[model samples]
Target chain A: MIWVNTIVQGILLGGLYALFAAGLSLVFGIMRLVNLAHGDLIVLGAYLILLLVTLLGLSPFVAVLVAAPAMFALGWALQRYMLNRVLGDDILPPLLVTFGLSIVLQNALLEGFSADSQRLPTAGLASASIELGAINVGVLPLMTLVTAVLVIVVLNQIFYRTRLGRAFRATSDDAVTASLMGIKPANIFAVATGIAMIIVTIAALYLGTRANFDPSVGPARLIYAFEAVIIGGLGSLWGTLLGGIIIGLAQTLGAAINPEWQILSGHIAFLLVLLVRPRGLFPRAVD
Target chain B: MTLINASSHRVEIATSASRLAAIAGFVIVVLLFAAPAFVSRRLLQDLFFILTMLGLAQCWNLLAGYGGLVSIGQQAFVGIGAYALFGTSILLGVNPVPAILIGGVVAALLAIPTAFFAFRLAGAYFAIGTWVIAEIVRLLVAQWKMLGGGTGTSLPNSIRREFWFTETIQDLFGVRAAASRDILAYWLALILVLSVIGGIYWLLRSRRGLALSAVRDNLQAARSVGVDALRMRWFVFISAAFGTGMIGALIYMQKARISPDAAFSVQDWTAYVIFIVVIGGIGTIEGPIIGVLVFFILQALLADFGSWYLMILGVIGIAVMLFAPRGLWGLFSDRTGIQLFPIRRRLVRPMISNDKREG
Candidate 1:
């Protein structure tokens, strides 16, 4: 019974990992850019949400509504003015640029927030848990998992159902041909990054509410998010979710065995998965 | 026998500027080597920092700039190398000098498994995969109780007594054991910088260097032309790890302390190295040499500003990537065409060439 409870808790935790990775996956799917700053951007989003909640006295949930659009604009501008300039034949520029951005974001956060850890005040929602037969689950983790699913579902709808989705697909397939067909790859990339940032905002809401965060935590989250992306395989959204679950399960199970092994277990699980499926469990693109 | 006579045509690999620069570089290195005699211990420590960082930057430039590996997790080698030195010295009672070499071997061995996993991903994903490996190594190393686990441990006082040159330097220099130790470390760092620079320059001028740049520019093209891409990548990756590990061990040995956090710090080992390479210029031997000096000066000037200094460096790195993608040395080279270490071969037609007579 206790083991079952741990498994359930692990699956719930996977939801948060998936949330952290969804934005990264989407950006990469469209632009083939692995933003080294994605984790820092998420941290930036959390701080933004924290700011709005504190300054406006709004509920944490409502603060995201205000922060999301702002984050979208920031992402859109970032892609248009910076990332697009460096996105050609050589892979070094974009990688280095994003890496520099990551350092800038992390240090800026430290300058602004200091080295102190901060958390979103969640009223009693953080401590609230519900029972399911022999197992119990935290409300925050449950909500996080549900929100992750919803975000993926909505992102899928935008990718397949909307005209914008067609533009995104066309541009991703071949930028020159897509541009010849009246689709602007730069604008599409900017829009895609904007949408990714909105997802980041949603992920930030949960991240801030569930745990304490400091400037230095972003890089660790980046490693986890990156692991989830790789385990899920490149360009596969659903695979990312499963990847997250695998990592989360590894961490929880490892912790169950020994507290010190929690993070190490997740990394080992990632390596194991790589050994078995080098292309990820659900590879979407042939490339 | 041939349409173009051998004596009439020459392949030139060095320019007048490069020849002059080579002589100047020798003089600079000689001065640096003798600095401990005239300089204060404080100055020696600072020079040690610059030399060690220059060595690491040179290694990274070889991997990323020449080989196109673009790894962001080089701290794995650095941390593992440091830990190996500490572990062997503390546990096996090995002398710290030889232990530094063992650290290099361990780091090179670790690279085999790391490459196995990281090579599965292409380009940007490869960068992230390496970072994951580094994190895994850091977490595991933290569990070693003999190394003081998470809190970390310092080298024993006996290490100072046991260090190869400490007493020799103490007697010769008439300084304290600690100052003599610093002087010895500074000399090691100077030697490391010279060897790393010389080794890289030699490699870049060799046949393998040509293959490396070819691989960097286009993997498929290089393979199509009969270049063994996998072998090249593996060779460069392992060599880089070995050099980086040795430097890591040397650094920690100088500090005389080892914590998983300090040993494995991504910011100190990887980020700073990356920044140095980017701002210096990725593909050239001269870039890192220039970049390290600039970095040292900037660091010294901004040491008091804390995070703001890092922010400024980050911004500078981004700006360089955007506007002058080849880095400061690249920009200067483009304008002046003055290569201090020329690798590009120019074909020169002699005044008595058959071509002139034929035309």
Candidate 2:
């Protein structure tokens, strides 16, 4: 019964990991960019939401509504002015630039927010749990999983069901040919990044509410997201969810045996998955 | 002008600037070596920092700038190497000096498995994969309770007192044990920097160097031309790990303390090194030397500002990548084709013209 409970909790935790990775997957799928600053940007969104909640006395839920659009604009401007300029044949510039951005964002957040950990002011929702058969699950965690599924569903709709989705697919397939057909790869990239940032804002809401976060934790978050993306396959959204669950399960099971091995177990599980399926369990793109 | 043989074309690797640099380099190295004799211990320590960083930057340059391996998890090697040094010295009762070598070996051995996993991913994914491996290593090292587990441990006082060359330096310089250790560490750093720089230069000027750069530029093209791209990657990867591990061990040995956090710090070990390489120039021998000096100056000036200093460094690094993609040295070299350590081979045509006969 306890083991079953742990497994349930693990699957719930996987929802947050999947949320962390969904934005990363979207950006990578369209642009083939592994934003080193993706995790930092998520933290930045959390900080933004935290600011709105504190300054205006709005609920964390409402604060995200306000922060999401602002984050989208920031992402659009970032991609347009910075990332697009460095995206070409050579991979070094984009990688280094984002790496620098990661450091800069982390430091800026530290300078502004101090080194102390901060959490979203969750009123009772954080502690509220409901009985589900044999296991009790936190309301926030359950909500997080639902939100992740919804985000993926909406993103998939935008990716496949819209005219803009056609442009995205065309540009991703061949930028030159897409350009010949009057699609602006640059604008598409910017919009994609902006949408990714909105997803980041959503992830931030759960991240801030669920646990305490400091500036330094961004990199660890990045590793977790990266592992999920890799384990799920390069461009597969559903694979990312499964990847997140595997990692979450590994962590919980490892912690059950020995608390110190929690994080290590997740990394080892990632390596083991890679050993068995180097292309990930559900690779979408051939690359 | 005298007539020369028409078929006397020869390949040239040396330029006037490089020849001049060679002489200047000798003088500078000799001065650096003699500095401990008269220089204050404080200055020696600073120099030590610059030299070790320069060494690490060069190792990274070889991996990323030349081999196109763009690893962001180099701290893996550094941390593992440092821990290996600590584990051997403390547990196996080995001397710290030779223990440093063992650290390099261990780190290189570890790279085989790291590469096995990381190579599965391409380009940007490879960078993240390597970082995951580094994190894994850090967590595992932290679990070694014998090494003080998470809190970390310090080298024994006896180890420091009996460290190689420390007694010799203490007697010769008539300095305190601490100052003698500083001097010895500084000398080791000096030697490491020299060898790293010299070895990289030598490798760059060799046939294999051509292949390595070929692999970096276009892997498929290089393979088409019969260059063993995979072999080159493995060779560069393992060599870099070995050098980085040695530097890591040496650094911790000098500090005489080891914590998994400090040893595996990406900001200190990897981020700073990456910035130095990016700011100096990525693909040239002159880049890291120039970069290390610039980085030292910047750190000296802005280090008091704490996180702000890092923000500034980050901003500068981004600006450099965007505006001066080749780095400060690359920008300068572009304006004036002066290569102080020239690696590009040129075909020097015969002085006498036989154009009519050839035509």
Quote the lDDT for B218 in model 2.
92
Interface DockQ per candidate = 0.91, 0.94
The residue pairs found clashing in candidate 1 are none
lDDT of each residue in B102-134, candidate 1, tens digit only: 999999999999999999888988898898899
True contacts kept of each: 0.92, 0.97
Fnat measured on candidate 1: 0.92
Runs in model 2 lying further than 4 Å from the true structure: B1-6, B353-359
> What is the alpha-carbon lDDT for the whole of candidate 1?
0.92
Interface RMSD (Å) of model 2?
A: 0.6
Model 1 lDDT tens row, A175-225: 999999999899999999999999999999999999999888888788888
Rate residue A243 of model 1 by lDDT.
Answer: 89
The Cα error of candidate 1 at residue A207, in Å, is 0.2
